[model samples]
Target: MKGTGEEVVSLFYIGTAIMLFLAFGLLFIVVTYQRHFFRMKRKEAENMLKVSLESEKNERARIAADLHDGVSGDLSAIKNYLSVLAKKESENKEIFDEIREGVDAALQNTRAVSHNLMPPLLETEGLVPALKGYLESIGAKAQIYFEVTANGAVALPASVAYQLFRVLQELTTNMVKYGNVSKCDINIALNKEALTIDITDDGTPFNFRENLAKPNASGLKNINSRLHAVGGVIVQEEEKQVGNHFTITLKNVNNA
Candidate 1:
């Protein structure tokens, strides 16, 4: 009887051990599946964002080309015809001049819009020159001075360059239009391991986080999205007392 009872006790212990092992295995499987599912979803989201950005870029280029080649060409033709009409019809010379001025202004505005949409310098000379040209044009109009400094090798993939350019463009535009900026400085640092851009502006003080939290802040959201697409980050330096300072960093430059 004693031996039989001992065998029954041993069987109970063995059963409990098997049951615990099965439970743990089931839990591990569940956890692993969940992780894999989340990872796949995150990857899908990133791919979607990239696709959207690429589509927007292509659309901007198309619109810019249309404006430059189609509308600008038409306006130029009209202006030339008007010039001929002004000389032939001297009695209505003032009328012709007025029309010519309007046409010229329209032409200038169209060209400016086209340039902003897809800067020719960006395609021909690269990011730095494009930025300099953009800032120069803005400064001419707004009297805001910009100082750009580049350090290390600044070569980047075309896609990355476009993203960074757009991000900076938004930030600077916001500063000039809303932050009351006068003087701004941009620093670009790049190496094999990392890429960093520091932008400082003597503008009206504002809270980056608070503004970002606003429901209507689509521009800020776009900036965040662009940075995320390139595996980059933007940090607002709180220690700056006078104005706003922002730093963008991408650690895996090669991978990005």
Candidate 2:
């Protein structure tokens, strides 16, 4: 009877162990499946974001081309005609000169708008030169100084460069408009494993994360989206006694 009891106890223990193992195996499979499903969804969302940004860029480029090639050309022709009229008709010289001045101003504005939409330097010279040219172009008008420096250099994909430039542009615009900025510094560093950009400003400090949560933070949201599409991240450093600092990082990118 005792032997029978021992055998029953052994059988019961073995059954429990097998049940526990089967339960754990089933749980692991379920968890793995859930993880994979979430990963796929995240990937799909990123792909959609990239597609949307690319479409926006293409549209901007088209509009810029139209403004430069079509509108600018027509305005130039008109200006030239006005110049000839001003010289030929001495009686209406003042009026022609006034009209010519207006046309010249319009031409300048059109070119500025088209350039802002899609900078030719960006397409031709690359990111650094584009940024420098942008800063120089805006320096006199914005009443703010900008300095750009690089520790290491690598040729970035055009898409990445465009998005990064847009991000910086948005931030600089915000600083100029709201931060009462005086001087801004932009530093770029690249290594085999990562690329980092540090932007600092001597301006009124603002809370980036807090502002990002506000309803009227579209510019900040756009910056976030652009970085996400490029697998980069922007982090605002903790505020000190003065100034604002932001860091952008991209990891595991192929420098080659």
Model 1 TM-score is 0.89
Total backbone clashes of candidate 2, pairs 3 or more residues apart or in separate chains: 0
Model 1 steric clash pairs = none
What are the runs in model 2 whose C-alpha is more than 4 Å off?
A: 1-27, 152-154
lDDT of 1 by residue, 1-256 (tens): 9999999999999999999999999999999999999999999999999999989989999999999999999999999999999999999999999999999999999999999999988877777888889999987788899888888447777778888899999998898789888999999988767888999999888887888999999999999999999899999998465789999998886676
> Which residue segments of model 1 deviate by more than 4 Å?
1-19, 252-255
Clashes of 1: 0
Q: 117-212, model 2: which lDDT tens digit per residue?
A: 999988887788899899887876889999999874556888888898899899988988898888999998888678899999989989999999
Instruction: State which candidate has the highest TM-score.
Output: 1
lDDT for 62 in candidate 1 is 98
TM-score of each: 0.89, 0.88
